[model samples]
Target: LVVFLFKQALTWIFGLLVVEKNLISYPYRLFFKKANKANFSFEYFIYPGLCALFSLYYPKNKSNLLKTLHFFISTSVIVIFEIIAVKYTKLIKYKKWTWYWSFITIWITDYVTHAFHKWFFKTKFHE
Candidate 1:
């Protein structure tokens, strides 16, 4: 729950920033339609849910190679969806943003969130 909320907050802020900068846009929004350009569902809900799942299932005791693989796979999956959304849907449209940018940011933020999660429950999480 903590990790979910934390990721939600982080993504929410960044999402708004990206939209404000015209790097991304959402033609259809489920919330805050008249006041915000960001997609509330994806930023505040889907992404946080994904981050929570990623952090919870991270292979903490695994080898470095496996850990890297985990990050690659998770980020790739997300990028794939974003690419699809960009190509086929009005839900998200990239202005100055690219798929690689999504990949890089997701990778970095997920790493940070995972680190925070581990630190917040240090004794409970073991490598």
Candidate 2:
């Protein structure tokens, strides 16, 4: 209900901020002087959207320890897979590794959004 809406709103705000920052600085720097490629690829949107959805469905009673462990494990696993995929196959290149900032940003953004949602929804943090 209220929590869901709050999460959605916060997610939208964070998404906009990321886009603006990329467009104003990162994209220009990556493309112009660096001669690096930059574009609105699928991962640009997918990671953040997945983060938002995960936050929305997070267990309310999960202990803080468990939640933190889950976060690290999940992030590490994804990073490892990406690294392997880039290294072994030509699926994604090394240059694209920097693009993972989107994942990190979304991770932080989702945590903040979850905090706000909890505060507004009167949800209690466990452990």
lDDT of 1 by residue, 22-81 (tens): 999898887989877888888888999999999888999999999999999999999999
User: What shift in Å separates residue 111 of candidate 2 from its native position after superposition?
Assistant: 2.5
Clashes of each: 0, 0
lDDT of each: 0.91, 0.53
| Top-lDDT structure, candidate number | 1
TM-scores vs. true structure, each candidate: 0.94, 0.46
Clashing pairs in 2: none
Report RMSD (Å) for each prediction in the order shown: 2.4, 7.5
lDDT of 1 at 60: 90
